[model samples]
Target: MDKALPRTIACVTAVLGLALALAGPAAATPGVPAPEASADGTLVSRTGTAVTVTAAVGLSNTISVWQAGDTIRVRDTGDTVTALGGCRPVSANEAVCPGAGSLTELVVHAGDQADDVTSFLESLGVTLVGGAGDDSLYGGGANDTLEGDEGADFLSGGGGNDTLTGSSGRDRLFGGPGNDSIEGRGGGDLINAGAGNDVVSGGNGNDQVIAGTGNDFVDGGPGQDTLDAVDEVGGNDYVRGGDESDTCRADLGDSVTECP
Candidate 1:
């Protein structure tokens, strides 16, 4: 454990305050922070070195998690929904949000336990950051992001074109149904860029990368990794196996860089 870390992790993240629903596993290390769950709902906050984010669930039950500068905040309420993309919710479930969505960043601190997060509504880019456990994080709407801080984690970009980062451990990363980007920062990893044109990197481990169905860029970085261009359509993709001895598969009209 890094003593420099704030020493807190997220247990689970609610979907706009759905904390009562996705309660998964315990922290790999104790003393991590997670929102409390009760009939009345709960409010929780975690602070890191440079950022602080809060999570909440209220009686009215709508979650709001966003970042302001370096300070990120989350609040869930049954009585009121937070103004997202400059549109205030007149009702809990109903809001005439504009087509051009506006939320840029959201922050969540998951514990070292296995956890999950979800959001549905407008294309507000949400960011979910996981802790030390084998966590699972999901991104929603337009241009979202998910980061698995430690442990064997799973990250999926749900709808919009998004970015997924597997920070450590043997993690699984999936890009969305849109043009996406993914990174396997360390440890052995499995990466799949699901749809549209994508960019991927398998960093510092023996990884299995499947560039799915698009003109994509794949980099098997610093390990004996396998890079596969699983291009089903008539698409050309690029693959590069970095550092160690690697295996690469590509189709015609595709570019290969230092990969065999």
Candidate 2:
């Protein structure tokens, strides 16, 4: 990454006297590939955030705990991982981790357990990949991207306009208070575009879409999907059930077509 990460992380170590001792990029694994591109930001954390920060993708069934300066690889057995980025534990799910690299976007692999991975409030355009267990992935107050890879997952975008994608398992994609875009890539999914205008797509399964109170667009791609905007206080939403046997319901200010 040519861009230098934000300098905030250096401040944390200088203030706390923590043993950051940042490491160079770990040698790449045999078959796994490095990330295609990297975004720039410091990696901070909040409490109750599952899945430790990572430098590598495609990890499985393990929490990759790296140090302040360590490359984002899974912590080897002999590698010493400190206390929540060397700050003392605040709670059971300790966070407030302070670290950063050249890239800010993330492609997580949180393994087979349920996880709640939330980006820092200062982050933007982060991309996370959840695991096979029910997970909740949240984008912060800026434009971000998240992918629910498997299991019954929940992807929510915060105040900034964001993008949410789902996978083969049932999912809930919520575009929070910003004008956002979301797609249920697979499975029987629930797409809720919560406040602000949005674009929603049910990729390839029986889906239920809730376009909440915004001038929005909904597309049920290829299954018996339910496009619902029946609330009285809803906005003018355009609903479409693609070339499939689907159900499209809406209010007066909305327009629906192509259900047949």
Candidate 3:
């Protein structure tokens, strides 16, 4: 951690607020105030220094923390963050942090984790994605999407437009932001929506999904699945698919999708 950077990490509680505060680093161009992070969200800073982040518990996924000057990508293992770009040797094990190009496109991709990576982000007040050993994901205040390739993963879209995919795992997903999308490709999965128009899909397994508080779309691709709209307002929802024995419940002004 650098001594000049602020000690307090801002944890953003809302995606829209984060977007309004800093309109993506991509637009900032060169020679501007880099995106400064706080426990509440991103801030404006013109300093170059390193900050040590203490990891939080019960939060899975890898976080890519960015600054205008430079970055130090710390991996749980040497191969934890695959495809590392612009990382130079800093010490025997640590390397110089890589720049995230632009703020609009802050890319921090996590490959696999033996534990929950969310705690690290929460402690540091950042948002990120990657593999989890538990396969269960809890979303935060940033617009994030996650995928679990194995095990039964549970995911929540805390805020912002999010996309979640549980590939090859029985998963649970929740959409809690801007029009969100979810896909569960294996095992039985569950999905829920909150405060935004959403699209959810289940594949090759028995699944349960609900569209709550927004005009939403639910797609139960295969196997015995359940779709319900007990907690939703105007926007209209679509429920599609029927494999083996599937059930669907809806209200008026909602679209029911049953495509064979």
Candidate 4:
């Protein structure tokens, strides 16, 4: 019995040693490396240390490979770029962007050309300023201010209390919600006050103004114009036709008085 026990113990010890030897190399070896992640947009060109990213039209993208002292160029191809992060405009065509991971404030500036611009908002606020050329701007959620400085423009305030100004040329303006203020500074313009109580003025040219929903104050400034404020059910609106011979339609309990 003693001889049989010695044989059994030796056989068990030999098996354990073989198993440990077989498992040692695998336990000591390093794991396989993870696949590298690619940047968001198409890498159009890489010259020396500078990289140019051509984001798909109407789509916004971020490149993570940008390091300090690296020049990053973005090409939007006539589409408006809404920055979800920090971006400062160096020129009408270029900008200094924030880091890829920091998706913070939305900083947006219009491009050089006169083109249509669209913006959407989440919980964060947005600011959109137009360029020298004719631009069409849409403000989607936040309390936004849409300013059309130079040429003929179209500005729409989607939600929030917004300020829309058409500085020059023939323009179109629409106010979506909350309390809004709209001004068409020059050329013949069309203005619509969508939901809340609003103050609207057609600055120059032969303009048309429509006050939709809430109590509104509308002024047709200068040229021959048309004003309509009959849309609100329980709203009291004031329509003043300024300067030239103007035609105005008012809601029940509303007032229409010609300017001196």
Candidate 5:
């Protein structure tokens, strides 16, 4: 895309040094397409033989690695060099185009399994946003936002004020710290308010919640549900209802507990 990405991404790439060298050149396979960058991000043709992303140019860029047949495309606004073959590893100190372009570094990946996405962000200590898939360890950083679209998913609010939402299917949410909100649209769900003021709501099926500390609010929107609050200066904790009977627990220190 022509629009510039946040400078923080570039800083992250530089600090983490997650850049790799472009793959070596090879004869074009008949149905294979070359990796190309687009406004949305990098689009790799499914038929591509290999895809390599040089850290120097693609650090600040969010490259969407996709496949089309045997081709792979890398679309972005940042500067890039292509080899039209397969990707390979390069040393951090390796020099290339000293004057024309600067170098960017990235941490090494330890696992042998295919871990392009996870290894990339883990190198930078930046959390990867979950797409339309089953995600377990989701959410990180201050005010992190986790969205699960389709399929069963799991979201965790690592720290600070966070928001977690599940669009469909069975979901699990954990509010780790600060004020947080967890919303589940469909299917049975489990929610945990780890700390701070938190709010949790379930859409359908059976649901369970463990509200940890501070003033908390929990709502079991449908089916049978259960709620818990251990011990605290528990004051007016709101528990909204939908259909069907629900069970609620009051801690020894509850000042004002409301359930319906």
Candidate 6:
């Protein structure tokens, strides 16, 4: 009876070991993992034409702010964030940052009192319908379009594919890069199309046009004017000194003569 009892106990122990092995490893605790630390933080505010952006402690280095149309964009390298100042979320890493009433398009009508307007944020689009007084318009950095109608205006396209039109004033137009179009209509104007493929025209006034780099088309219409299509590498450009006696200069023997 003692030997039989020992054999029975051994068999039971072996069976228990087999069942334990069949039950697989214990399941891990069922819960979500903790999130990582955020990399950027930002705050935005505005007063009149001036807009301010402040970054959180330790996150100032990683945050960048820019303007697109009427909306400002705040970017963070870390986690996604909600909108601020009525700005819409652009992506997980970016949000539109605006101060109070943000504008997607800023238009200045004729007879308005404002003379100088500037866009602090990069990429904001602005349009000026000139009054009798002279005006100055600046497009910081982004694809911007500016029009000067009437007064002798100064328009600058900081960066991007900017389109600037000066109508009826002795204006100065500058196109920064990324393919630009500049036109001076009815007054003596100065135009510089800097880099990228550009189209520049001086209508009716004694104008000076410089096509800087890339393929360009330049026209000096009416009065005596100067057209320069010369670059370091002598770009491929089509230049026409229209109407009255004009001077046309080109590099690498690139052909530029009288208007067709």
Best by TM-score: 1
Candidate 6 least-lDDT 10 residues: 26-35
- Candidate 1 positional error at 114, Å: 2.0
Any runs in candidate 1 off by more than 4 Å, and if so which? Answer: 1-104, 232-235
Q: List the candidate 6 regions with Cα displacement exceeding 4 Å.
A: 1-114
lDDT of 5 by residue, 120-155 (tens): 121112222334446443443445445555557677
TM per prediction: 0.63, 0.61, 0.57, 0.61, 0.51, 0.59
lDDT winner, 1 or 6: 6
Q: What overall lDDT goes with each candidate model?
A: 0.60, 0.58, 0.50, 0.60, 0.47, 0.60
- Candidate 5 or 2, higher TM-score: 2
Q: Kindly list the per-residue Cα lDDT of model 6 for residues 1-260, writing each as its tens digit.
A: 56555654453344334323322221111112212222334333334554333333332123344555545665545334444444566786566645424445433232322245454545455443434446666676766666665578888877877778786878999888767767788899999989977777788889999989876767788989989888865426667798889988876534466843
lDDT of 1: 0.60
Give the better candidate number (1 or 3) by lDDT.
Answer: 1
lDDT of 4 by residue, 46-161 (tens): 33322223333223222221223423333343432323233444443344554422323333345334655565543334445555577777886767667777688888988987
Q: Write down the worst ten-residue block by lDDT for model 1.
A: 8-17
Candidate 1, backbone clash total: 13
Give model 5's clash tally.
33
Where's the lowest-lDDT run of ten residues in candidate 2?
Answer: 21-30
- For residue 36, give model 4's deviation from the true position in Å: 36
Tens digits of per-residue lDDT for model 2 on 132-152?
Answer: 578778777878767677688
Better of 4 and 6 by TM-score: 4
What TM-score should be assigned to candidate 3?
A: 0.57
Candidate 1 per-residue lDDT over residues 60-122, each given as its tens digit: 233344433433344444333233333344454333323222334345554445655554523
The local lDDT score (0 to 100) that residue 84 gets in candidate 6 is: 43
